[model samples]
Target chain A: MIPVLEAPPRAPSLDIDCELAAAWLVAFLRDEMIERRNVRRAVVGLSGGVDSAVTAYLCARALGAENVTCVRMPYRTSSTDSLDDARAVTEALGCVERTIEIAGAVDGYLVNEPDADGRRRGNVMARTRMIVLFDQSAKLGALPIGTGNKTERLMGYFTWHADDSPPLNPIGDLFKTQVWALARHLGVPERIVAKAPSADLEANQTDENDLGITYLEADRILSLMLAGYADAKIAARGFAPADVALVRGKVDGTHWKRHLPTTAMLSNTAINEFYLRPVDF
Target chain B: MKLAIVQAKPRKGDVEANFAALGEVFAQLASEERPYDAIVLPEAALTGYFLEGGVYELAFETEALAARIAALWRAAPGASRAPVDVVVGFFENAGGTFYNAALYLEIAEASHRIVHVHRKMFLPTYGVFDEERFLSRGRHLAAFDTRFGRMAMLICEDAWHAIMPTLAAIKGARVLVVPSASPGRGFAAGGELESVAHWRNVLQSYAVEHGMFVIYAGLAGFEGGKGMTGSSALIDPFGDTVARLPALGAAVLRAEIDFSEIDVARARLPLLGDLGSVLPDLLFDDDLMPENVRRGGERPVTP
Candidate 1:
């Protein structure tokens, strides 16, 4: 485990011009789908969160409302407000909407393992949602557009091979803070943006409550650390040392989750070492 | 001199839209504290290169294009310090013939001058390139004086020819600027674009061999289903990459180049010093060849 710093780092300015960012994201989504993927339709999993809402909005603008589909995968413990927010996004964007409950699929596996904890149950739910999303993708003949933001990705806050399983992601580069900014820019409802961020894995669980650090603080430290700043320098920027260490530890510990499964390199003709091609190609 | 290379995507067949985008980029750069002496944009930046049927309509006259570009520079936010020279690629319409050309503009406080226009000499006609079909080819290859220093411009294919850079160096050019719109092709096993790697090799060789600064500004984003490799870079006299923009995106890369490096490298290598003696042998001469080969009818014996 990485050692904890003495103090938390101050939040750095990570503001992005919403109009320019919206235009770029819209173009990227449209180009990646039509030019690269050869598909005009897009499917997004909306959890009544800012990331998904903003991604769905951008997709609607890119591929048009007729080409975008918003899927809501709610568990038994999922909040009613989450469902409302997801529906609101689809309605506002004038895109098609579908809701497929994961309670039956998740409980089918959990029934055999009575001692399965919240983390295990949550993984099962996330993966089940992914399965449903992909199924709906096939049914709708659209690409699965991901809503995972950069901050959550860098800190390994997302479930491996589950929430990050989409083929194309528009918000993967934007930090969580930037996503909120963009959400507001895209005219996303204030209720969704102001709501406390949650994975909805369990009842009454918030992301900050679980991580023990605000995204503003985490994003600042992560950006600095990724930019090649030393911990000493980051600490000098008024970040609490404990929060810094915790954020650093999460990023360092989850390195494996960010990349493809490591293949043993016994020969030069290894898969990644030879016969490589871009996924879009 | 400080130079900035803009790796940007151009709207195909829309010169007005591209000009507006370029103006925004210039304004963004001007707002920064970094002082740039020269700005290099990608080949056919004003009118995208792959416009097979629209080249005639998109091509601009030199005088009108210069006036519009001057207005953009004049409207930039930064106050005038030293004259910032701009090297931009465009489709030029001269006497009803269209040519792929690079226009060099020297922008001053209240006025701008069109210094030199280097038309692309070698029109590529093979494999994804169909330049000779629509555009007329250029004839001359020469270097011209700029506010920063003596420089030469090459549009895409011209830089690939050895004679172009050699001739530019012989013409007392210390800086070689290449504007390209080459499509991205072939990915290596490690997921790197092979076209970018190939360009780095090609550009670096010219910089190191001639002991001159080579600036290669490649277009970014997709055009006609082909992704342009945006490896716009500035290579120093020592063949070191001073600055490089990331591939497949729009960016402005800045770097400071010391002109003295040319003198320092040439003094150490002495390749240019021996060129005078080697030129005589390189020139084609029928008498220097075998009798059978010189007749142009018979094949010469190997032995």
Candidate 2:
């Protein structure tokens, strides 16, 4: 039998405003607990980024910090800088925090083959972090929270096996720049928000560096172009033609990844197709 | 003690054009000296309904359009006092997605400021209205603070959900403004009431139960090829329909609502006080389960 794999989650198309981001977590939890009455607690992956920090803060406000947990899963190469920032958030907000190191588990899985390529090493780190998060979530009876911001998700930059859990996300709609703005609003440390972001799997890894453009430029271009503004109008916003082309290609080519897996003879509930439904999806 | 409704048909996909058209109407009203305590407009007044457009096709330039609409509010004032607060519909793009929006316009002397903008939260994906197809549903349910009494806004499907208006009133909103667009032909498809009465009944019940006034405004045009039939009305905190619009045509509903009546009605009726009463032994197995009731735990037995 072929193994069934859950696709990694993609970020939302819109660049969410900070107020909306905080409001969504606030509203979802409030309605669920007050209206639905099933919710008692919330759990999140605190990556020390602005997105996760703000989500964590909102979850605490929505569910009370006593009922919220912040899980920090750090890889061996993961910098102490981010870990400290994550701790600062938990401590400042009076939230519970736990640490699970994944370097040993990932290192044990890799044969090294005399010398492994960078891609293999990075996958090992990304997948292992997800494994750690899910394992703890199951043990604690908590939901795993997603940490990817919208820009990375739009470009299909997240690892599938690690980040996509059906009900585990609270920050998928915010863009990278908006994430920074939210982090400041939530009182996260400046160093965490100001530094160039990275996955910490390699010596020099940053989202913009890998995407070949910064989020501020990409979001402006994507937002404007998506709004049907002319290329000339978008370029006037300080983006190079190459940057625009690269982002446009990424958005177009990976559009399939944003959708569900397609197949012939699609049903109302086909894997990746949209159709009429008896109930709301 | 007089009220006025400003019902204008929205142009498809042109917010700037719609704003211009509204300016003309406001000018005409000013010239005629048609003074009103408050003016209510349709949902998505800025950008016409995007029931068909996907994320890539919708217009979300709310930042640019708000100033223009606010300028129109600046043009209209009540009787030289605190000025009228105009409650109109528009599309907002604060979160990188098009939202079905309602704006509260308050004219202070010569300047009209948008005090609150409410986004449509409950997106209807089924039937003729596929709002989930374009804009992001809102996360806020509380009403805005306006001179028209602590007023709040709800769009289309939001009135059906009790929490949106309930939270608004709890947050100090005395008046709830619901802007709706009901499909005409779909009203009775094969003798099934497709959300026509549901819209009116839900808002009316919520107003009476919560002791809050409900000002419902619906678009008077055929939206999304669905041929929208208008059924706008104002329901007081007593669950009685105070004023209903014409059975079928372009008409702005105006009514005199004294919010001071709410406290007296509630004090006399005291129906909402029973909200906290528990029927632990009786199980309500019905289509409607007040969201709070479904989260079941055995009620403590009192001796």
Candidate 3:
């Protein structure tokens, strides 16, 4: 009989300070809004999950609560508890709130394709939510803030160009564990912080269950890999070989999603080559 | 010896505010059980470097500024517990002339001593730097004795010249402290900043050539839309980066430097011994040109 492999023992702590992380993100968001984006207002899609909740809180702190607009976009299959958690965050942050139902737009696309799989429906839902968020951003004169964390982004857990289409992201550099740490430091609700992370795209869908890996183990492996550790060395550190192979495959497969669109170079002076200016400038 | 290198973003034209921020970092360090022999800060850490119109107003008198830093050090909880030296950079106003300077302060029990001050010799005046327009150049370069060893100080541009570190080595300095306010520029294919790679190369070359520990402490944050690359690092005599801080934000990095590595490196490769023979031939020569070459006339072509 084959034995089941368990994850390696967790590291004691990540190398981060919640207080400093919170302060830096707030300052970065403020600078991005006032200095770079030239917009006084910011709009964030607040899911019940920790990522969006923390992002909304940071936006509220960076820009004033009056200038931040929190949007809760839920599909028909989205859980009721997720909406309640989103409302809890908006009320706690004292920001303007809007609820945009994405069920009609998503189902309208899925109606013709009755045999569509779960992945297709999930992509449609994510794209529909993005459309609503962007349209609301134009109406409110606010820039859309991204809520994707580094862990999910690295593992290709998010729909490319759909959930990853925002112009700016505050927590993009932070891992999932770091996000929870910063969320607690920023006074996010304990219930929201403790809740299992989910996309709420389909019924009874949890991130860990879908990915078949807990965030704690995934973050530890990802950090080591990103720090230039080889796969053999990572597996020698007590991580299961299957887990390491899975992570390496995901990261390698998602390489195209993380970069800008490839442009064919026709001349010496390309668009992004010769003519370049900093985003802030 | 244990050392802490701080890469901080100074509020432009605000000296007191920058001091307060440094004071907070010191307080935080004090709470830790770790003991450091010295703390190194970036160039012009008190006042941002690119202040075009406010140079004179922000320059500090040596004694007055020393007293303020002494007060902050004495107030820190670790000052009484452990004797720690601080190396910081600031704009100096002496005899109505402004010069970029590095100050080394020794904080002992109940006393804050101003040990040495090394003004920057090379004031960069090219593209983004115009230090000569508002500041006077330093006239001398020397190494001083410290608790760690004989250490020398050099501001940003001074370290760029290979001759400056050579001079320090000639003066029996084993450690070189460089405080920099370099702006970030250029990008490579891997998306890493070119300035970071350039600075790493510069630091490694000096450390390997001199068999000395090189500390490159740089500033963080943006001023006038130009961001300072905060790749503050500690390099061993073997040219390996022992410790490094990230490139964008304010951070305090701590690492212990082993002085005994200098002896090991020097014994393995005696570059200094080779320099002893090479210096005289380069310095004492009266005529470096050929006899046929005249002062003002064109030289005859050799057949």
Instruction: List model 2 lDDT by residue over A109-172, tens digit each.
Output: 7866537787778877778877777777677666566677778777777666565542545556
**lDDT of every model, 2 decimals:** 0.83, 0.67, 0.84
Query: Model 2 over residues B1-303: C-alpha lDDT tens digits?
Result: 346565555645555676787877666555445466677776755445543443334455554555665567566433344476677776666757677778776766666666887888888887556677666888877656666568778887787878677677666677888877765432212232345557767888888877888888777543332334456788888888898774244576768888788997788776555543432223364433565354444444569
**Alpha-carbon RMSD to native, per candidate:** 15.9, 24.2, 13.4
Model 1 interface RMSD over true interface Cα atoms: 13.9
Over A79-168, each residue of candidate 3 has an lDDT whose tens digit, in order, gives 999999999999998999999888788888899999999999899888888888788889989999899999999999998887889888
Q: For residues B72-152, what per-residue lDDT tens digits would candidate 1 score against the true structure?
A: 977877835668888889889997999999999988877889999999989999877778878899988878988767989
Docking class of 3: incorrect
Model 2 CA lDDT for position A168: 43
Instruction: Considering the two chains of model 2, state its CAPRI-style docking category.
Output: incorrect
* Stretches of candidate 3 exceeding 4 Å from the true structure: A1-13, A273-277, B1-303
Residue B220 in model 2: lDDT: 55
Clashing pairs in 2: A8-A160, A11-A153, A260-A272, B45-B89, B121-B138, B143-B152
Model 1 over residues A1-281: C-alpha lDDT tens digits?
99987886444457676765576567677667885557999889999999999999999999899899898999889999899999999889899998888989999989999999999999999999889888888987889988899999988998999999988787887789889988997899999999999998899999999888999998889888977888888988889899889999999999999899998888766775543323432
Comparing 2 with 3 on TM-score, the higher-scoring candidate is 3
The better candidate by lDDT, 1 or 3, is 3
